[model samples]
Target: MKHLKEVDAVTTELREALAGAGVVLPSLRPDPVSIAHRYNPPLVELGRCSMEVARRLTAALTPTRQSRGERP
Candidate 1:
């Protein structure tokens, strides 16, 4: 039960973080297999998104020139 809660918290955190970056993973959630009380640690399912969303996620993950202290 504790593990499940923790995993859920993680999922929520990730969702909020991604939203902050303008990235919304529609199917984001905890992996059922991993959260079946069979594993100590749970896995997060990012699910699939459109190419546009994927590109946006990649851009968010990547540091831009300005973010790296360089002029664009």
Candidate 2:
């Protein structure tokens, strides 16, 4: 739990980012095992979402005219 706060902060930030893109990760959390060890940095587990969520996420991540402040 060394980086507990840091992990939570990052997880929350990601949630907000996803929210801005109309995405929701129902089971977002910090991986306990990852933080427990000292070998690697803590990991934020996005957990699971539906196909629609996947598609939306992909769309948000992908470049589009709207994202670039362009008009159709």
Show the colliding residue pairs in model 2.
none
lDDT of 1 by residue, 1-72 (tens): 888888899999999999999999999999998887575688899999999999999999999999899986
TM-score of each: 0.90, 0.81
Each prediction's RMSD to truth: 1.2, 2.1
lDDT of 2 by residue, 1-72 (tens): 558889999999999999999999899999888988787889999898999999999998999998789998
Backbone clash total, candidate 1 = 0
Clashing pairs in 1: none
* Candidate no. 1 TM-score: 0.90
- Candidate 1 regions with alpha-carbon error over 4 angstroms: none
Candidate 2 stretches greater than 4 Å from native: 66-72
Error of 2 at 53 (Å): 0.3
